[model samples]
Target: MNTDVLVVGAGPTGLALGIDLARRGVDALVVEKADRLFPGSRGKGIQPRTMEVFDDLGVLDAILAVGGTYPVGMVWQDGERVGEHRMFDPAEPTEDSPYNAPWMVPQWRTQEVLFARLVELGGRVAFGREVVGFERADQEADGVTVRFAAGPDVRARYVVAADGGRSVVRRTLGIGMTGETVDPNPLLVADTRITGLDRDNWHIFPPRGEHAGYLSICPLAGTEDFQVVAQFPEGTRVDLSAEAIRAVVAARSHLAPESVTEVRWASDFRPRAALADRFRSGRVFLAGDAAHVHSPAGGQGLNTSVQDAYNLGWKLGAVLRGGAPAALLGTYEEERRPVAGQMLGISTGVHRGEVRRGEATRQLGLGYRESSLTEETRTAPAGLCAGDRAPDGKLAGVRLFDAFRGPHWTLVAVGVEAPELPESVRVVTGDEQPSYGKGLFLVRPDGYVGWAGEDTSRLADYLDRGVTR
Candidate 1:
């Protein structure tokens, strides 16, 4: 095989998966059709759960340094400030959950950071190389061969399609997508530089009368630019040129046409939520937008995509390097397809004003409770259970997150007799952990609790299914 994994597309999902595999010492290659990284502030909001995933991938520090909290929304009408609107429900940071709010970092900057981290880990991306078609090996151990539009055919044990919604790979594999348009009205989104608006608040302008649409201009954190969003009529053709953007701002708000100085990037779309019929087909797997497409409403698209990579990365690594059965890779679709469906619903609800961006949008509550990999051995469970996220807290002298911060499982024996675990798995013994209560919590490499029990009778059997001693 040419490589263990071939990741198509160099977006956030592909780069993140590359970083994970490189750190695991897996031979992988990322190929992108574009000559350069994406250049837009489209998916700007990073949810709290994704922040935890970044922490594990070794990019949280840079992400925190470059991103900032979302500002309060300010309403305007006839050039007068009317009221202030809070974008998200306020939540305080607790010991178990340190990141309580959404972070603002342009999608372009997030990709750049992930790319830098991937390069630092010795992973490389081949630009301008697009996949035209691929075929699975006739024999299970022979691997798959992929043909590119401008390069020679490449072979790999597995291939991940991270290419966007219009995925040629998905189409070639005969996969169908099912979804509906979340909004009939066409919306315009742009990144621009304006002079008259203050950077302190997210400016909002409601419709003036029966004819006009609403406009919102938000200052993107960590950058000297603003993201402008406007709604148009059902069949109105949205203009994206710099002059057109300036005209929209001038006609909708108090800002003059000349106040809009530079137009960095602009695009138009009608919000839609979609999910692929299947996430896997033999040796090929679909992830990110290829598997599911969401409305940008609740900021779930990018966060969900990043978590998809995080979930699939470790399973692939374990199958290839940890002597686990190939069937372990099948759990990716089983565990993530339901999550993608739920997130799609949330995004659509937020778009239709049927839901609020509160606990659900934070994504900390999402887990794999119904997954086949989750083993809840305890007859009577307590605070935390299998498939729940292992909350972060100080246990004894070591932080739980510090112990769980790598590509390895963690056995946390809190106020219980510890068992002999595999050398590959890390152990943290503590007298008491407030969030976890008293029990044995087996934290997976992806930061979810894989098993919870009162004793170690079945722990060894669980380990035998995956990791080797």
Candidate 2:
């Protein structure tokens, strides 16, 4: 059997890429080692950028309907409430954002959403199919032959190792993951229901000794269930026993120890930041944990993986259909590599703050306006840079469909003449109401700021960057 793209691992990244490819009428297969979906709330915070990606896939409303909105700001220190940060506010867009705030949902639920969409797109994940080896059809030619357990050899023009950090595909390709796995600190992670607690805010506890942790409580989307998170010293671990969880809850929430019930899931793991020197070798590409791994400081690990899949999906689809150049795939690494590097840096700072119990890391400093793929930064003001995710807002008198509409190339014309704009571009009048800002804007298929200007001088180049002339 063969496919256009054989994605190893059916996690969020692999499933997302599969869905995108299938939606564009490309043949792709997602092979997972596990017999069934992994159940648990590994990482729960979804970023604003990720929500916009969901919108592009036409599943944002369903995911949001299942997941509750977490609009409260974050607090510093454990239980001390030194300061705050807002999750979703209408007042943040710089005249061009498409999403007002991020949504909070469990990792498992996120996979469920993507999986359902993949099925709708005519792509199904082949579970219990493990990819154990890789072969080169030609030394210089970049085609790969993949071997799976108890199945015929599957030959593909391209293969992506969306397998986890400890990827067998990466190892088979002789790709070395160079980074430190050092765990000077260890922490326990658990998912359970705490009956008595305010579901609105994320509660963090004060620092304890050389180690620190927070109790994360958020409403599980579409249920009365509340997911809980508690951290301990690097050397400390979670005791899943009722008494253990109860004691921790009582101390953290100042509630009765018996109030904590239903110990659903739990685990212990250390944190590490590792990145592959290269994301692609020949016809094989690495994504998700296969390409990079970092601490879940900003809840970015899953989101980054999704973005990686998004970046590769369309390029792969276009290349397979002969609509775009193969070199478009090169931009995946060029764009995501630096983003991963920056994420590692920021996560390190976040962990350092948690370890030392220092003040919360300032979030305003975390923007990706430095990437070359971001045309907005080129035309942005003095302080602006590329690599940042585009912002979102609502248009007045527009139906709900128009609000979240468009995988099209969006151009918001300011004072510039709109009548002269090409028919290929979807141009909209700039929004200047109290809920929205004003400026010429362009959004990519994957929800990044592609072009923004007060004039048409840069519009030609911006449109050319995403598609072939």
TM-score for each model:
0.98, 0.77
Candidate 2 C-alpha lDDT tens digits along 30-110? 999899876777777666666667778878887887776564645645434576655333334344444445566777888
List clashing residue pairs in candidate 1.
none
Give the lowest summed-lDDT range of ten residues in model 2. Answer: 356-365
Name the regions of candidate 2 deviating beyond 4 angstroms.
71-95, 137-142, 181-183, 196-221, 224-260, 354-443, 449-466
Q: What is the lDDT of residue 203 in candidate 2?
A: 52
RMSD of each: 1.3, 5.3
lDDT of each: 0.92, 0.67
List residue ranges in candidate 1 displaced over 4 A.
136-141, 467-469
